[model samples]
Target: ARRVVATLSIGKRSHFATARVAMEAYAKRVGAEFVVVDSTAHASLARWNATLHSGSNSHFMKLPMLQWFLEHYDQLLFLDDDVLVSPFAPDLFSSVPCEAFGAVYEGYHKQGWHSMHARSFCSLYGLA
Candidate 1:
């Protein structure tokens, strides 16, 4: 049996709380384990080297926590707090190639303003 987990980083943003609730409900409906990494607490953990900043971009600690989760779960679906999972959404794990990570690509043609941001992310993470 393949064990899968849904992971999210919870920050201090008011809007994120609403998304968290929806994500939790979605996880329950899918019968998947939902893990919330409290970004506030994670930032406080010095071992992770996260700066104590109160913003949505303060996710430096997620890398370590995600690594920890990989040890236990066969697959991990990481969703941002702003992401809303529709009940009709397909099983993402089934579509992902084995031994590979998956992410939605928001291309420049789709959303121009965010293209530079996406490019920066790709460059920083060395993604193709």
Candidate 2:
């Protein structure tokens, strides 16, 4: 939870109210205050494509989380749901350089696991 603690925002206090009991319990344990938000992945590839395209210019897929960041932080780490951050996670970002960062990508199709073009995205790595 150390990774999540420093990023959770308090701007949307009302929205996070419903989860207060559980959230507070979590906060007490991990020392975080997670604000709630809705996340709805689009149904079609076309929509997802458009969202990514538009996101590059304006508010991206981060949406509500982006809003929370705008209201409370300058830079926030964005972690994909599937990743498992190790105990050493917090130190991962403490030394990263500026502008560029590391990510997990489907290196050329030469390295394959079957069906199609390799899909790549960042997970567990620190984001600035």
- Per-residue lDDT for 1-128 in model 2, tens only? 23232223224344233323333343345343443333333221233346566665434435544444444533334433223334233333333432335455634544454222112211222211
Candidate 2's C-alpha runs over 4 A off are 1-60, 67-71, 97-128
Predicted structure 2, TM vs. truth: 0.31
Alpha-carbon shift of residue 13 in model 1 (angstroms): 1.7
Each candidate: what lDDT? 0.60, 0.36
Question: 1-128 in candidate 1: lDDT tens per residue?
Answer: 24444455555665555456656766666666777766545422443543444344445766766676677677777787656555467777677854998888844455565445445544543442
How close is every model to the real structure, measured as TM-score? 0.60, 0.31
Q: CA RMSD for every model?
A: 10.5, 12.8
What local lDDT score does residue 75 receive in model 1, on the 0 to 100 scale? 74
Clashing pairs in 1: none
**Among all candidates shown, the one with the greatest TM-score:** 1
Give the Å shift of residue 24 in candidate 1.
1.9
Instruction: Show where candidate 1 strays beyond 4 Å.
Output: 1-5, 8-10, 39-59, 107-128
